[model samples]
Target: MPTEGVTGANKGIGYEIVKALCQRYNGHVYLTARNAIKGNAAACKLRKLGLYPIFHQLDIGDEESIKKFRDYITKHEGGIDLLFNNAGVSFNECTQAYAKEAENVINVNYFGTLHAVEILGPILRYGARIINTSSFFGHLSNIPSSSLRNRLAARSLTVDGLCHLMNEYLSDVRNGVHVTKGWGDSPYTVSKVGVAALTIVLQRMFDNDPEKRQISVNSVHPGYTQTDLTGNMGTYTAEEGARSALFAGLDAEGLRGQFVWDNLAIIDWYAATPPKSF
Candidate 1:
């Protein structure tokens, strides 16, 4: 089974991930969104295309909503095979007007993703694949500011540390000090950086233990897909973007915790400057 969130998935990469999984995987797939209407609409569209993806209402930001989805999955599907953390938000143009960019973006993209993982971690089957939808913008090399780069590259980082840093960045943004102080450029960047960092940290954590030995967790850049998160100005289509995610989800054997794009591996930031495409 598969769990997809932020089902406003009306028409974008989220929808495309749903479509791609249906076409590729024969197991049960859960097409989830915060809105029931939108979730069903997207599922119905897939149904018309001869794919039978199930619709469930889920809000990654809400603990209750996440629990409800988890319970539904446990009762119906027993457990999940793949958990794709694809729900994200950005306030590029709008947050600038209100100066709430960091707050808004981190709440959805960072915290929301973690919340889903927290709720679903216990229910994931052995050998289950977890795909975190990160971005190239999340790369640390993109942040040229030295002070901010150092903060973003803090050592021995954990999910709690990452969450704390994101909150600190949000506070800076709201106080109108982050931009002037060079903490970060935008909430989107800060939140995504946290995501990418969280990806590597989680990889190390997941790979270290023998009990949690069957899980493979990884992150990927969908490679500039045309989606609402990008304001529809991306060069690639949602289907193209879902390619790497699907690769991570279904075919990623003996390859856990690797960040990828275009079906290839990405070089780490310490190894190079201003990372090139994988």
Candidate 2:
């Protein structure tokens, strides 16, 4: 049986994903949370329902936490067969300075996810499946500048180049010149754009890897689900939001470096406007 792992599984969509996997997947499920008590309690709830789930502490925002989880998994399971990068943070309203909020959101959402992928890349076995939880806002069209969108979607863009571009967005925002520079001020949107782009980069890396080849990486937009992140403004429940990711991660075929939507449909991240089907 292939082992499965999920980050930030204590509640919301992450929790629902773990629940679905525990019920359907014929393998051990690792449910990780930044808070140990919450993580354990979540796993215990599943166990009470006669479903088995293992708990691990993973704070994607913390480099040490990510590395520790990677080491533990490699030592015990040799590697993971499936991974869902479902952990992220978002800001609400206009409470803090744009720079401060952008820094916090970008750090946890883009750099943090990037670090987690980089650290765990070595331990991802061949035939592994990785689902990156992006958002509809991740689409290139969300960025106002056509040149910026093209640059991000360029096939020649390397991971280092992508990292540089992300920092550039931060720099522009910090200097109060993001609007002029064509990098929008929404850190959450930009971070998720990074994630959407990173999915493609990772897939290319896996395809090129001689030893750790045959892996699949894709991004999924969980919809405007009602979660703490969204301040419960969305109508879709957490379970509804988890559907597309679960399908994309566990059931979909030949979905390499693609973007998925809440309706279990493949999304064109480059579309200038949302599909009518949306």
Candidate 3:
């Protein structure tokens, strides 16, 4: 069983990921999106390719919609083996970002994903896999500041600490204290950081639960994929960027709780040693 979200399957990386899954697994893959017309069209296109991918309408931000989709999945598919949290959004104008826009991005990218996991956790059978789409922009190295950058890069910082930092950062954003307090300026950056941190938390949680055999939860940076999210400024094709995701989604032989890039595992050095930033 394959589950995808925010898939404008006719175009971009989300579409490419679905195609790759169909080719590699040749199983029942769910194509999900909030827009029915676009989703069905994409499904039809894939159908013409002779890959019968199922289409489902899912708005990640809406809890009721998520439950409805979950119910449908339970009744029809029995259980899901993979859950790909690939849907997210961000505003174009980064410099002139507003609180509401930032909130919306965080809500969809961070909270929406969390909600999906919460509701779908029970249905994911043993040895299930979950891949969260994150970005290199969330990397601490990208921050140019000497102090905050060092703090973010520090080793000995636990995932819990990172979550706390992210909460504080967003709180600052909401209270208009970020700029004045010299916090990270971009909301997208902060939200992506939260995404990475969240992955670490889930991975560890799954790891500690001895009842299962490696749930294999990880985050991916779909490197510079040409999607509507990037406004077509990306250098890589959507299919190319999704290569890592394909590897993580299907290759569940011996891996779990890794942040991957280009189909290989990456260690969050800062997460391992949070207090020892370089």
Candidate 4:
């Protein structure tokens, strides 16, 4: 049977994604979290509901942790058919130096995600589906610099360039010059922008890959939802918020490198427009 894995699935939308997959997917679903105690607790809760989710520990911010998970998957499952890079960190306020906060957030949301895909991409089965859980503010327009936006969307841009671009943002943040550099102050939004961009670029690589894995990569904006990420202040619940990602990860057909809304609609991230209400 095909196997699937999710990151940061102890709670929130990630947990809901695992729950939905366990209920519907005709495959083994692994629910992973960075914290072993919380991860196991979440798995127990699901077990009470008669949903069995194999709990694994994953911390996207840590490269060693990711490599361990990758090796575990390779040994236990041979490979995987689905991967949801849903693990991320976001905060409404920063108590410490903004740069420090930016580092942590970007490490998990952007660089960490990039690394996860880099390590796990090889294991994705032929015709596998990969989905990144982006944010509503992940659009290119979130960055005020037209030049940076153009660079990000340039056909010549590669994963290396994406890494450099994000590193530049961090340097600017540390120097307290991110605003002048055209990157907004919100690390969460910027990192999510990286995720969205990663989705597009990854899909391109997959399409042109000599291996011809025929994998499809896409992104989903789950809308503002109530969860730990948002301090439980949102218009929707976690279960409802997960629907968009579920659609992208499991149900999307003939879609590759597209950004989708919570209402199951795809849009142009290049265009700066109001987000559609689900």
lDDT of 3: 0.71
Worst 10 residues of 4 by lDDT: 91-100
lDDT of 2 by residue, 1-278 (tens): 57888998999999999999999999879999999999999999989999899999999999999999999998888888899999999965566677888888888888988898889988888788899999988888888888999999899988999999999998898788988888776888899999999999888877888876688999999988989899877869999999989999888999999998878889788788765324
Which parts of model 1 are misplaced by more than 4 Å? 1-10, 95-97, 269-272
In model 2, the runs with Cα more than 4 Å from the true position are 276-278
Better of 1 and 2 by lDDT: 2
TM-score of 3: 0.84
Q: Which pairs clash inside model 3? A: 154-277, 155-273, 155-274, 155-275, 155-276, 156-273, 156-274, 157-273, 157-274, 157-275
Question: Each candidate: RMSD to true structure?
Answer: 2.4, 1.3, 4.3, 1.1
TM-scores, each model vs. reference: 0.90, 0.96, 0.84, 0.97
* Full candidate order by lDDT, most accurate first: 2, 4, 1, 3
Q: For model 3, what is the alpha-carbon lDDT of residue 164? A: 66
Clashing pairs in 2: none
Off by over 4 Å in 3: 1-10, 94-97, 142-167, 180-182, 263-278
| Reference-based lDDT, each prediction | 0.74, 0.89, 0.71, 0.89
Residue 99, candidate 3: Cα error in Å is: 0.6
